[model samples]
Target: MPDYSFLNLSPAEFEVLTRDLLQKELGLHLESFTSGRDGGIDLRHSRSRKREVIVQCKRYTGFASLKANLEQEVEKVKKLKPERYIICTSVGLTPGQKNQLLTLFNPFILAPGDIFGRDDLNNLLSKFPEVERSHFKLWLSSTEILQRILHSKIYNQSAFEEEKIKETVRLFVSNDSFGDGLKLIERHRYLLISGSPGIGKTTLARVISYHYLANGYEDFIFLSGSIDEAYSLYNADRKQLFLFDDFLGKTFLHLKLGRNEDERIIRFIERIAKSDNKLLILTTREYILAQARLSYEVFEKPAIRLANCILDLEGYTKQVRSKILYNHIFFSNLDQAYIENLLEKSSYQRIIAHKNYSPRIIETVLENISTIRPEEFVSKFIGYLDYQDSIWKHVYESQITPFSQLILANLLTAGTPIAMNDLELLIRAFAERFASKYGIVYSQIAFNKAITELENTFIRSSRDSKDKLVIDYANPSIQDFLVTYLNDLQDMMGDVIDTACFFNQLVSFFAYEGPGTPSQRPRRTHLAVTPYLATKLVNRLTQNFVELPSSTLKKRLNSNTEPYYYQVRRSVYNKLNFLRHSNLYTNNIAMRNFTLEFFKLIMIPNHVQSEDIGHYVSLVIYFHNEIPFEEEKILAALAPNIETLSDYHDFKQLEALYTETYAKFISKSAAYKEAVRQMVDWEAENVDTLDIRDFVDDIHAIVDHTKIDLANVIIDLEEKFQERDRDYDPDEIYDHDEDVRSEYRAEEENISDMFDSLK
Candidate 1:
């Protein structure tokens, strides 16, 4: 039996739970009354034309409080003179206390069973488990479940706090998505939840994860980094559930996915699909997913298409929207005056029925209610709903201080999940450069004060897998707000660029116009750079590239660690790609000279790895007409690394260059053909260890390029599939179709009555 503390629910939720349980226990469809001034009636069912059975529900934690509240209700009950009166209280009542209550109501009480207390409610829940499950908040908030959820190893991600999880469960109103998500995950062993911003994609993912956790899953793994992290942490014997929130980069695709990341993610999904003990849940903005599919051909696979669960506002029915609003208001810390104002005139209907109704907007407004003047609360609240885009704008402009705002600006410019130390360095750098313009004094004390104010509001500080303190926006909306804010204030772009601690920040702010770039805006918000701003940005990049910091150079030379190496490599790649794709490099002669000089300085043959070789080849190919580099040196770099070119993507790039560009000078060489044959042979030998999904395309490419026969490898893959099919069991799978349909029907029937009780 689940030990549920009804105290976790608001009085309104408690009332609804009581009504549902009693309706099940007594076989009567009771009509519920509005919460305030009930006139001695909470719920009533007509037994005949002349009389009705009446129920009075009091949600109190103590017997004394329950008795005192019921004493005031006695006279109202007497005047109505119902056929039978039943009293229900959350406070546990002893036999003596029940008798004492029976004396006060006399004939109205009729029997001790008529006075239902806390224990009786629990007993009813045990008997009617369906009712217990229907009230998600009631069971999810149980102390045992919350303890289990919080104690899971996955909570180290810092996004999942104890109070936050509890509050999320309390306020979450189930909709069709919950059931749909369950069926999808159960059937596919993976789910990709996509939706518009603020439509509760992450919330739905967390809810589904919690459901599996409460069932029998051993761990809830949060994939905070690349899909490789999932592969690293996967335990074949353990029933581990994994979540990758905003799997496609949150702000932009370039920042999120690296070379072949799309392929890597698809392969990881296939791996999860084959595993019986694993479940993967991913969430991304709908536009981001669309952009990914357009940018990366690998994402267009049928598996990815089947795994998508798109959450739309249409899925939120009027009743579902009402319950969402009612839950937020009921659990909110708003003063009674504000609550009354919302309840007055059924004003909540306007909000629910508004064109721009969003759960995020509602949560943001309610969260900052203390900042709004009581007199203007109603108008301002409705105003925010009217202008949904301005919800964060209002908060950013009015609620936060200018110092905190600067902190957010620099944090945004610096990019997300930046080290706390690095952000402090950038903040101090910004203050040193432009403190007087913003009318603020710069000090360690001031910086600390600003960060303290913004924590969990504008920004959140969390330790990553490495246990390094890093900061990211509290939510994506903050990043969204900051991007729009910064772009509109182009005057600050120069200052932002000048004060940036690293060159990558400058690159993140602008998108270049070229083929293969997203037709839609990049997820990473980019500023609309004018010609003047573009020139200024180009100059900064040139200066940074030409005069590489001595300390950074020393680190690059001294450290061989993968992280440091990759950091430098990624920064260099972003700069080169920006120049190659953007007009900044094409139109500016001086910028081109500086870029070539920088390339000569860093693109050493011995230092270049196989993974990075393609970057150099693509860069050289793009600038083949303008810049001159030795063909012999390029071939020299390619020859020794031929055997290491194992990734199919590398071969695809070479093939493209060979088939359609000036780079055939390198790709049509003896060394290139030998490299292709070696890679195909290596794969054929190690086929059993490789994922078939990854190698299937590779095999096709091999057959096209080298006419390599892989009959034995294909036979091996077929046998593996046959073995998997033989082991499959329909009885082992849990079907949520019936449960979901029942839950929807129950919610649909009760939602109207539940909101009516709030009037």
Candidate 2:
């Protein structure tokens, strides 16, 4: 049972609920409206044609103070002279207070049992379930909540107009085969409804659920918690309708579940696919449904997936949109007099025909029109919806609390759904650090309260496949709102570096040593951020590269450890890939330079995994193409380690470029050739003592020597050659040519060995 103590209702709302209860339960005709005073009575009713009853509602909390309020109402009762008077209070009076009230009023005028309090109201509401739904709707599950919403004061049986929907649905045969879809559901026992938000998908699902409930379905189960919980709730022996809202994925934000939940869902589907009595109805946003198919491969299979039962509600005609808008507005709680006046205005036609109009937009405009004059509401609302910035600003300012703002900043900075517990930690840490900056001390209780508030509006929390609660911004629109809002705040405060570092710290959890043994250690409980999301966070954070501190960038580039070696390197590689594929930054010099520096920091001196060699080489290629000043240094550092290249396929491109560039540079350098010749002559003279490896090392060292000295060394070698030639006999000259050829071939073999070692 829900705790009634947690039920918070304002005075006017409580009175309205009381009036609804009285009207529904007592069969009373209310003669007075909720607002204006009718001789200080809240409601007037007549039991018989001649007998009048007066009701006064006081939502007082203090029992001691009830007598004072009662005395004031007692005076109004005496003046009205009703046959019966009833006083209603949210808090029941104490026994002494009640006895005191009874004694003050004349026994003939007021009876002892006429005073109704909270307990009495609860009993009345228990008797009228429909009234409870109509008045108090916030604290209920899905089907009940939707039932109350659909049958609200603005929308009721007469206002539903299913026939109009049916007529409109027929126009888009390919869009919504409503009859065929239902027929497929009957055959398959599973129906997946996919559509854009506010496109009548949930409304249609609710309509179907209502139909099944009307047809004697025993239960309406809204999915939450685990699939095991869902399985326990399902009864094959009874007729049941399971409403899985946003079944394919999250409606407001994108989140990836762990493999366990997907497998559970697949198993659930397998069971439901063969069921006869159990029916499952699922609704999801269109793109999310597609993503689900990718996430769960079984969803793509024809036999297990129930592919034929899928319905896409697209291709909505203008006439249908207008009808949908009209139905929502007609039954909405807008002021009837203002609605009537606006219906006559030509400006109203513009609202109906406006290209930007949507049911959600219209509903938002009509939700609270009491603050604005009815005559001007529609016109002003239409103008408001036309401006996207205005809507974003209004939504951001309206829903964002300070704690929630910090949450948004972190999520936006993280650019992924953070685990709920981890997110709370982030918020708490951020609050502690920026306490003086924000001018508020935050506690855990405050953080929890703020999170709950966010969940009701902009933030959404759901269990992933791992059964861990993860939180995300409700949708792409919310993300957009936060990005713009927080970017401005970050600019003014210059805290992007701080935010980036916080997320970076969280991501370092990915590098945790290991899960270890179960006997020695408990399971690791923390958010597991995907590599894809990590890449996204890095990309987003770097968008403010100019503002990022050098120290922060240095930390970002520190990916040399074993745990984060691949993850950070991949993040940088992915960013470069994005730049390569995208046109947004054709010549982003700062990003290019920053990424080059990052590559320099992450480059491996030894062998990388064969699988990752391609990614490593890609980073090298990016340096060669983008960072001219560092290209030669990067290649030279990598050149000595070419033997570490595990796969030729991974290094084929790099090999070709390195070879072509080295060959071209060598051919252009006469000084380099002279240096090589002198090194060969010196090795020939020292042939008996010199090792081939040592000789090759000396040749490499000479390549870096000055040109003038290399020429002098060559001249000295030529003089030695001339002196040797003069001392030799004519016959010995031929013998000398053969010896020189032998030495030259030996040196050539040694040079090839040096090149082979590099390979």
Candidate 3:
């Protein structure tokens, strides 16, 4: 007999199968099966109005072992007084088991072939392809469908439950939004549902897809984070519904997309709007979608604007949350004590009002209800909800292997998918370089095994359109948790220096050697590290370095950051904020002393953004008030390019530095004496008597001082302006004096002539 064990049908699922088989295959009018009152009769069938048959279904896999259940079912069937009856089971019965059952019923009621078993069910399924396709859909699905469903189910088990999906959807207690969403998609041809993490956007999309699938739309496809694949799945000729979950991106913090990906997505949606037979539905985190609106501006396009319908799932009512919690509790297998405890008015209200209450959180909490003590259940549930980071940390610490943890660290650090080949290279490279520090070694095969272990939990591997196995965190929060955990690990580990070295290597790898660029060899794959992740790793290094003693921080700070210039700048900016408020940091002689050198290292621009250049300069000047820099220190900080500097606040601070530096310089030393002498010479050669003030103003303009700096520079400059004639060449000075006298004598002669002529 064919093995139907792969079906793994539950009791309820088996009944659904039997009901469909009788009505679809047997061509009989049958009564529906009702739960809790089936009375051993799953169905009553009538054929040709003259013959009436009774049917019974037992989902038992071991018919021989369950003889008692069979006998009891037989007794219940006998009371129905049916002229004919058939016993259907998922497993075949032995001759002894069949003979015992045969003896229990009347000969007219039961015959030798009256019992149907696995072989019989297989044959029936073979005969009716439609029934197999619908009822045993998973077993009958094509490999592509099976793989897609299996892969998606690993990150989310909803796809598995989808096979035996109950009429009542769990976790999503309300259908009102789903109904409205469905109508919007149907009417507009496109819909984008946006919401927070774990707010049931995906669930509502699933329900909508399943509804269309039920309505005879055969080409249902799902895509996540890839518009090219979604475009490939689009079939305009057939009636279909396409679902693109998190289409804008996942991980709001690191939403790095392929170039022009947003444009392609907008174009795809525009195409869908024109197609009458095809429908599109998309979902994304609300903040991410909002960012997309700002970044892509696709929603502003007239065609897309008209076709788009956004449903935001925020501010869920308390009643809705309560209902959601109850739904999860109802479906999950919690102990009676736990269930009763959760049902208590106070316990129910506590979860409903908890700040962290969400559909996904509720599912996670209730699924582990069996492990929690009944007495501690309520408090623990609230605790887990309140601190989801703790839960993620525990999951990471408990479920992951050492090598797998390293891989996850890399993935989180990389901030995007690492292809299998590229991931192998990264693992091998890190092991060879830092094996002594992290205390582990991994061969390629061992690395493969480790990743296999993490397949569905911390990391997920999926084939992109190129058919490369790209690995990423199962979700964005997983990445966030791992990054945070690794930063904490930097402090907790005993080998602090080695760990710092390890993080530096990680920083370097992402900064330069990371993926996303094509290799020199044809067909060779490389994963490019995202800029966000590279910046994050550098930031991590800065964070680690700041906690170390002054000696260590200075030692690391002295190293050349030329290769990772931009990232180092951002990291330093972040550190400046961290150290800005702490008196401990502010007072530390080492940090205070190293402040100028640290600022100089990060301020050195290597193709950094213009705005960032301003930011770096600002960090130094803002902290200058506390760090106490001299004239040279001000010049050193301002020595880098300032034309690109645009931040007004930092600009104001930069002005303050110049003004304060000039004031101190004039009082303490003749720093500006030479420049002042040159300014005086220029004014004498270029100016007439009337233009002397203009020449003095020109000297002020040439100095390039701010309003604040001008006041102090001008005070010393005015005296120098009066004495400019002495500093000029002696002939130039004497000639200018003689010309002044000649002009005065000429004006006197004119006045005398006028007076004599008037007399």
Candidate 4:
């Protein structure tokens, strides 16, 4: 609908258009046209009625504030007394660049932003808008060695592979959270994505760009730094998807730009990104982790988020990795037996075998794969651990960095003490899930040693407190510091961890049950404790406990101790009575069963938050067989209380300090909606009962609803906020000193009185 084709104009084509307009309209004749010289202009003018115009053209994607440079060049041409001077840029100058251009007071025309004032220039730009549509809308399928790779059909290469890849995509997309990102993309007017290096940023970008291109969408133009090679892509004619890989041209974060000239470039790109309906997709590998929380300033965060769409690219999970492997091998000689053997034996080789696997290392490995070069293929695998041998050679040789510390900060967030058993359990559990993506060996020792460091660094224990380990998750600064240093040498640290617990758990599981999909794996309660589960437990208690009235809890406790610190009192147990009827009480049942069998217990995760719901839904459908009215009622009753949760209770009394945390149930509606939809779709369609329902169609329905809902919610909230602010009178609220809302004098008196009391 919008004309976003800015990349279709060539310098010569633009020059011709301008020259033809001048000649036809003004009856001006030129002897010859000459362009592009290092310095000094060459112009042959035989006509006297029409003035000779000297032009400088700059075509670029990076910071395009060349207006000052153009002005200087114009001044140089002025000294020559050239009758006219013109500057044309592929992208355009910023407001400041245009202001600088106007300051010259030269008798010349500046096209685009410089020539047209603000809205006028943007209005002109609106004539040729950028693409803001889906890849499917463009009918463009994947171009990522799609034909070549699919022809080989490596993952299903032998035969009947299409079905397998489809199955793989289904499996990968099954994790409801995995695709939450796509909603942001489709719902917004502007979006930016940033992630750690080698997280499939470019691959996701390529998939997005090429998919749109193949769909016959003409309102979009694709551009990357590589597109610069085309030379004619910056014209106002090209508008579609612009997939830029390795954008944000500045290299190191701390390093300063070479000259003032650098600022000009930044100014240029800022204008392009700020423009409406124009999608500029970019990728970068390096960004500070502190930039995780999105901010108002566009530059503050490494990622993009605007009115349009913003989808982040997190790398493949265990399911995705297995699917990828299957897809790749299926195309070639990877037979199901060989595939199963590889699947069974091959563990995830971390891109950062020493740290974390980044998409670049993954891409580098895959890109170099060749039938002729087995060693190269091996090198790619080894490269996943490149830093171990190369970057952190000594650390690996010595095995000194604490492995727990590496992933600890990331692991611990709920303000609770980190338990050794729980920490070990988390590491093993996570490793197994995406086992093949990162080359992590199962270890319990690393978990234990890391626990020692945790004790030394942040752990505090008191005899009076239940669970004894006092850890505050709210203080993320310390966690941030640890995560940074630890991830830097994760490879060296991994070896330091003890694998006994990891191996023992595996042995126990093998003794009882065989390894396979989710259900086939050892049930969590049967294995060692995990920190993720521990945190989930803490969060869950926060939810349920906070919901209970503090007055009743205070009466129950009857002592000067936090409620959570006390043994399971009547206050908490009585509340559980309300929960037992719901299926979400799985963890509750497990906890009761455990305490009944043993004596004391730790925390348990709510059914609402856990990924177990996917498994739960599967079980429900399998048992029901057909979706009868009674079955629907049973399913509805058991559905995660995500949207139904209306009340949020506060544990703190008198005057409560406030912070917001969403109820897991309240936040999971979108994910749960898809989960339920997929369950229904799975029941409706023919899905292999052997594998969990990988229902694509129902998943799309959920995705579409999510996107629409997000867009509507964001827009609606923004409108209401704006409308509410419209009648605001700031002066009226400047607050009279007697307003009493100000607690300054009272607080000051309290402070003095408290000091006197201490005396």
- Candidate 3 residue lDDT tens string, 1-759: 224542344343456667776676667777755433466666687653436688777766576655667766666765666778877787777777677777876653567577777677777766775666554222433343344433431211224443444422333444356656765676567788888777788877876665555555656666654565555444445776778877765422333344356667777776666556667888877766666666566566775674348886776666556556654654465667776666555566787788877686676666455557997878788887787666666566766677777777655444454456656765676677678767788786789889889877667776533344566666655654554466544322222222333322332212122344432211111123333433444454455754532100000111221110011233445445434432322333444455455765555435433345445565666656655545554444333323321332243355566776655553443433343444345444544332355555755654454322434434554565567546444342112222211110000112111112111
Q: lDDT tens digits, residues 1-759, model 4?
A: 222212222222233333333343335563334333424342223334355555444433333345544544655666655556544454544677666565564555443332432233234333422211111211121233234324321110122233433322321212212233333333332235566554555545544433333333233333322222112222223433444454432111111212222333333344344333233455554343222223113344344333233344554454344323322333343223332333232323332233454434433334334421442343435544554222222222233343443344334221133333444454675555544544445566655565555443344322222433323322212333333343344332232222212211111111112122132221211221233332333234334442432111100111332212222222332333323222223333343343222211211213332223232333233323332223322233344332211100111110121112222332444644554444443333432221112223333444453332333333443454466457544454212343322111000111111112111
lDDT of 3 at 273: 63
lDDT of 1 by residue, 5-113 (tens): 5876766667788999999999999987656577888889986845889999887889888888888988898789998899988888899999999999998888999
lDDT of 2 by residue, 1-759 (tens): 222321244344456667777887668776644332445667788767447877777766676676676676667666667777677777755666666766766652366566676677777777776666543222232344335433432210122444443332222112133454555566667788877655566666665665565445666666532344456555556777777766654322223442256766666766665555566777776766666676567667766656777786665554455445544443454456665655553345676567666555665566545545776776667775686344546655665576666666665544444566656665666776777887757887888887887774577776533355666556434554554454345231234324454423323112111123121111121222223333443465466533322111100112221110011233444334434422122233344455567666666434444345455676667666554434344334333332221322344456455776555434554643443454355554653221233334444444453222344444554565566556444452112222211110000112111112111
What are the Cα lDDT values of the candidates? 0.70, 0.51, 0.54, 0.34
List candidate 4 segments past 4 Å from native: 1-190, 215-238, 258-277, 288-298, 301-312, 315-317, 332-341, 344-759
TM-score of 3: 0.47
Q: By TM-score, is 2 or 3 better?
A: 3
Q: In model 3, where is the ten-residue run with the lowest total lDDT? A: 740-749
Which stretches of model 1 miss by more than 4 angstroms?
1-3, 27-40, 68-72, 159-161, 251-256, 389-391, 398-401, 511-524, 546-568, 571-574, 582-606, 625-632, 642-652, 655-742, 745-759
Best candidate according to TM-score:
1
TM value for model 4 = 0.25
Candidate 1: C-alpha lDDT: 0.70
- The residue pairs in collision within model 3 are 515-527, 515-528, 516-527, 516-528
- Runs of candidate 2 exceeding 4 Å displacement: 1-181, 224-238, 251-257, 260-267, 290-299, 303-307, 317-320, 336-341, 344-348, 354-356, 368-376, 383-392, 398-403, 411-423, 435-455, 459-759
- Alpha carbon deviation, residue 580, candidate 3 (Å): 27
lDDT of 1 at 75: 85
